[model samples]
Target chain A: MPGIDECLLEAMKLPGARGAAVVDWTSGLALGTAGESQSGDHEATAAETAELARIAAEYQSFAPADGSDWSDDDTPVEDLIVSSRDSYHVLQFVRTTFDSSVFLYLWLGRTEGNLALARIRLREMARQLVLG
Target chain B: MLHRLAAEKATGSLMRERGTLYLSDGQVIHAESPDTPGLDVLLTAGGALSPEQWGEALTEAGPQQLVGRFLVDRGHFPEGALELCHLGALYDAAFFVLGRGGGPARFRYGVAHWMGAVRPVPVDAVQRETSRRREMLNEIWPEDDTDTQPLVQTGLGLDTGLPRRQRAVAELVDGVRTAADISRALGRPAFHTLVDVRRLAAAGIVTAARRPPRAANAPTRLPETSAAPDVSLLRRIKNALEAL
Candidate 1:
């Protein structure tokens, strides 16, 4: 029920959360953003992180060994976690009804953020995001 | 031209040969083109909403210029799904509109689309993304023929382990679907379709089929999104998957 802004605001309430964005991995655009971005520019962060998301989503090597079939609109790989020295970057793939190319990106500080909680919360958020 | 309009804080539609840009207070609120699928197609055709649902929503809210709000209020999905698709469709069409510069255009002051304002983009951002997208496509494959011309599988063979999207693009190549056509078929952004086509071309998986010359005034047909579902195409895909 939470819209992009509301969802992002909710993300900001997470411990150690610094910034959040809903990004399209295909075109590298930030559809919506909240909090403070790592690079001080949400668009730049979106474009740069999209490369990583695309790599993970599209590359065959990232597929599961079980070999379950997946369409382009649905990436089997759910979330990508990149940890830096000071913070954790979490990219959770959001499923839409059509062309699910978006992911929720959360930038969290290492000291205060609970990685497990963020992962669980983001998955639920991704699952519930309706606008297909 | 659009930049000047942006400076003037113009509100209306900038009509061009390729597409139209809907500006509100100098910001781009919407855009559409013959070369790209609109939000309705992106939503319904892409399987986010059924055609019936879309038809109903349009019938109810389109006249009020509140389809975006209607979709949001309906709460079928979660939130921000419309915005994501809206931005994608807007940028896809705006790319074509931006390309039509240096030509005569018909600008109407105080025009707006029925979808209402989902989100407005700055003139600078749209232009920046358009150029970047152009460069990105060129970087993949310089030729633009695969974009506008009918596509046929080269049958020279495709690389193993192609990405899922490119594989879907590969499946639809029967010498009739252009990149735009395939975008309509797949219900994704035209830019994504073109990007996939260019990559497939680079991999020798698909190629643009040449057509005979036509007279200058003979208009090239645009893909009709309102057409009934392509049962044959779906059948072919279903059969192919079964065979595999």
Candidate 2:
């Protein structure tokens, strides 16, 4: 299985990859970051992206007629993607029996990305990533 | 007839000119309106599915059985989650109705939505939690417009003796930050961050910024990310009377 750096290196191999980072969505902490900063404030953008993931989740869990349970702990999240005119922002959530709180964020160019292949590659990366 | 149809526990696309609202048992389970960002945005944002997964789900389902199961199925979201999404979809559609949000839309009723083997959350509890959030916000600002406006924190500076968490918030007082960003910085849960922000906002500790004027004629773009507190967010927190 590829480690964190290898996971990002693999993502950079995508057609229009711009930047990549492994972020803890819960903490807005970037374990590792590569590429030019989207807004010059990597920490701020990471926090904002993490917030987006969270609000969307809370909104879903609170819909009317909902019958599921949300344990009094952090829910496991999978992946998140935010598409804009120039780039695709991706967040992939990872879980290990020992720990399950890290995620990977990949930003790719809209034109350069082949949506299907990028998805497939990202899925593969998630399965193999090893975190410290 | 549709209301009656819903009462009968029917399933189908309940399309409206504005958008289509879906249901399984008089209670809404899934919704889609072309004039809005649609379910993909909400689902992707919520971390339930990746953009690629959502696309695949759309292609695989072919719009009828697929969207329904994608939402209702156990693996995708809990029933509470679907309901919340359904509401968001409706809100998005309602916001875009008569606007340029485009779609050839129609609602079909009486067909089984067949969301695959999903579990349900207690609706009442979720509603209560949301209401609690709303009330908390109201106590802080008591206004809806503040929600849409840019969030900026203009203060003197963080006091030295404050607790780490409050200090963290004080650090963010310079520029406007979102609840999500604050959550990430403090390493706290989103809800907890929201609660504190509201408390701070209510105590007159935080002031809401005015909304930006809408741009017209130009290709619309999302707002630029705001700046962070850099020794500038704090001003008078150190010496002002408790009343101020």
DockQ of 1: 0.52
Share of native interface contacts recovered by each model = 0.66, 0.00
Model 2 stretches astray by more than 4 angstroms: A1-132, B1-21, B31-49, B67-133, B139-141, B156-197, B203-205, B211-243
What tens digits encode model 2's per-residue C-alpha lDDT throughout B1-244? 4456545765565555555545555544543434334555545653555777766666767456556456345255443334333443433343323222335645465654433222222223223333434544454344343333334654634444343344455466445665545544443334444444554564455555765556777787875567854222242342245555
lDDT for residue A42 in candidate 2, whole number 0-100: 62
* CAPRI quality of model 1: medium
Sliding window of 10 residues with minimal summed lDDT for model 2 chain A: A66-75
Q: Judging by TM-score against the true structure, name the best candidate.
A: 1
For candidate 2 chain B, the 10 contiguous residues with the lowest summed lDDT are B116-125
